[model samples]
Target: MMITFTRILICFLLMVMFSNLQAQQLFQLSDDYIVKTYSERWELDSVYQQGTFRLMSYKPIYLAPVRWSSKPNDKPTSDNPDFSSTTSFPYNNIEAKFQVSFKTKLVQGIFWGKGDIWLGYTQKAHWQVFNTGLSRVFRELNYEPEIVFKYPVRWKFFGGQFRSVGLSFNHQSNGRDLPNSRSWNRIIFHMGYQNDDWIITLNPWIRLEDEEDENPNIGKYIGNAEINVAYNYHRHQFYSIITHPFNQIKGGSIQLNYVFPLKGHLRGHVQLFEGYGETLIDYNFRQTTLGFGISFADW
Candidate 1:
């Protein structure tokens, strides 16, 4: 027990050491590079001028070599027996994970130059890279594609600026066959606010009625809404995502992340997640996970 404790302590110490080292370079910005405001980040209200069809980062693109889950779901089960896995596989507690997310402007200045439309796609995968005995199979892969129509708002709320409101059609799926398949669709409403370096977003979604439900109880576990908070301080970024069902808070999740600059356009990322819905296959399985790696985008 002492040895295990020591190992964990060492890992934490190393993370702190690297963060400090990388922080030194975070402040060294180029002459032409300008720090962006919350509105500028989304190019809202013509604050940041951009053309259509330009691809941009929608979410944090990251790869973690070490992602440890306290409880690995080897046998994924769902309320729908057709979507539950029949056989259990050997899933490692520690594995590699990666995510890639991007967005492109489809129509700019629509609705009499007040609205914009975007198409976004995000994919995240878990790989059992260290479990060579299982021949290094990909444990789970989730794909999300969304279409958003966003409009900038300029309302004041407690000295903060209400920045934007939007609606999104989102589809998330594992792209798998029966007994391992999981998928869901949602109509999400988005609202964003900004106060100095702090940005907050609320996304409330309703599940679309499907003839053949993949996971009928997914909403009970993954929640119907998300609250995201982000703050930037001297080139260091901190973010948190909280989700919970409206009926109760027992089935929800919280994820915290810290990111600091490492190199040009590259940053070190550390993430901690607790509860359900870390992945599509693990939507109903609760776990605590810690991951350390690098990311190319923020939020």
Candidate 2:
């Protein structure tokens, strides 16, 4: 009777183990299909995620016209009836920017985690055609490469919501092709909080570069801070940005951008920038500009 009881107990244990293994296999298969289906749906909604390897390119043509007036008092002369003279100049400008970028998400995990790397190049050419028949052209080129790592924060500060943080390292350079060309290394920390229609991003970045005449007064160590806020309503998005520099020599810039979607995949961008200190090339101290561009991204 004891031997029979032992054999029966061993058989029961083996059957339970086999049943658990079958259940685990079925669960895994179901989970995998769910992920695959979600990925396909996401791609259909946003063409930006359509491909395993993605490439995007943009070219923009811009025209700018500006007028400046100055008044000067010259030494009183017999031929001159008035001591004050005014001069006004109207300048016509044209600028072109071309950019190309490629990105690939190398790894994706079951826990909604992903890793990606991107490389991009941008070229800008500008021409100034003065009414006085004088013309000048300038060109600039930049190359950037970056890697990013992100994970869900899983903690809520104000309310029960979803949030995430990411760390990235980027290298950008002008390839010494332009005058005063230099390279910079940047470390960026980004945090985002999303609650329904509102999304907020706080980005604090540090930039390091070797001392060069290009950035003379600004020390080799420079810090930058940016805050970005976006509000989404239905299919529309509005964004504003503020940037601050730690060093006086580096200056600061503020921008507001609005996007409106049109038919198909085309979208329009209207941007305004107000800068102080050396942020602007022409005004080295203070400058303001308004610009508009078109974007073709997944809506």
Candidate 3:
């Protein structure tokens, strides 16, 4: 137990060590090669809040109970008649509820002409942390590492600033093997626009075909693209993620988020999720869940 805790501590330290380096170079002026200061941007209630991922809809650290609306139909790999998928999972899922999530950009620099590169990582874990009756196991952990190339653009539509355009390659997986493993790679195009307190980004992505199909039917439930819209007012941040299923049969997921300052460097976070894609294991299972936790940064 002590060894496990030590490892987790080490990981957190490494994440912070790398993220701090990028935070120093975040959102800098491209032409002048000078760093962008917080005073140049809009004033915030807290200086600690001035960081990256301001317009991105996804945040970290959400812990709450989840109820499955439609449980997935089990698939059997072995052809035994009595074979059941639930044999590996006999515990009551209704009692499992906990989460630890975070994202950080490790490094960023000017890459080429008028463009920059950033390396970032985000992880989401569903923990039965408090469910001691179930041996307090971690249910699932999904790690995503992405490298993005961002280029500033001078364009406007709907009277807003067309801030930047980004292209990236992202890979997401649970790092598990065999029956429970899930992984995918995608190419994303990001177009960002901001008007006053409102920020919107359209992320159109295409999944790269793979030789070994882990979750073959994932596209039907998670869809081909995502849209993020966020509005900032005073010290509050509101955001949402929308996805429409490719087919009418399997539904998509919609997540709503609200974050406000609770104390110094600490903010109260509320997450409302409906439909699918709540977790990798529940990618095809429809569910509704609400999580309440604290976040250090929305970026």
Candidate 4:
């Protein structure tokens, strides 16, 4: 699996590097989170217009939906019933079929010229909201926070315009301790470019070793880089995120997202994902899933 995924990634990189490109264009920054995502091609938007951050558009508004994972994973603490109900709560959860998911950034802004910083957080939880037999227990919740700095760039590469570059510090965990604890941190470098109607972002990161090493070797499974490519056509958007390890390829993840304007302000979204790392708890697990929902932005 890893080998196959790596090959795919290599081909993807080659194609993007050599692809003919013309110009760099992104939506101008505004007071809407959804608009912010599609307006600017990169997190560091000052490259387009260096100015103050506005209200309401501080970060992403909210992206909420339900997802179904074909493959389920057990918690390090649960999936085994010996402990049954611990002092924390009720019985251990058996992976639920459905989940309530959403991720939103807290705040982001540019404090000075050419340099901007951002603070963001996201959460995803497994919920048996419909199953009455199991009393509708919550399965797992993964929390993530990240701070980033983006610098506007003006350069030509691959016959395309380089738009932005920056660095970020990211942390993800379940917020549990001991047997249930799982967390990791990363220092990531990102660069952005645009070609015709396409926006491209490349990110390669290094995992900061944890003293506790919970969910060790996550990088081996999730890879060291994440690439996002988006294409725009009228009122439709098509995007995909891919990650892979070059040395070994057994584990990796690919996600494709489609957004089409359904009406005024609301857009229909469809997501198809295969492989691993959809959530923190499922960081080392593998699965293929299809999720549908309404998105506030193109993603």
The lDDT, on a scale of 0 to 1, for candidate 1 is 0.81
Q: Candidate 4: misplaced stretches above 4 Å?
A: 1-66, 75-112
Candidate 3 residue lDDT tens string, 1-299: 32243346437646565646465444221221111221122211134233443322123444444423233323422122222243454333443344433334323234443454555556676665555665966667777666666666658788887777887888777666556666778899987777777777788888898767666667787777778787766677787888765557557789888877766545677777788677666666676766667544442
Worst 10 contiguous positions by lDDT, candidate 1:
26-35
Q: Residue-pair clashes per candidate, as listed?
A: 0, 0, 0, 4
Give all candidate RMSDs, comma-separated. 10.9, 20.2, 8.0, 11.9
lDDT of 4 at 20: 27
Tell me the tens digit of each residue's lDDT in model 4 across 2-65. Answer: 2243344335433432442222311222223333332363444544443332211222222335
Best model number under lDDT: 1
Give the per-residue Cα lDDT of candidate 4 at 32.
Answer: 39
> Where does model 1 exceed 4 Å of error?
1-35
Where does candidate 2 stray beyond 4 Å?
1-102, 110-138, 160-162, 176-178, 209-213, 216-223, 246-250, 276-285
Q: Give the Cα-based TM-score of candidate 4 against the true structure.
A: 0.71
TM-score of model 2 (CA atoms): 0.56
By TM-score, how accurate is candidate 3?
A: 0.71
The residue pairs that clash in candidate 2, if any, are none
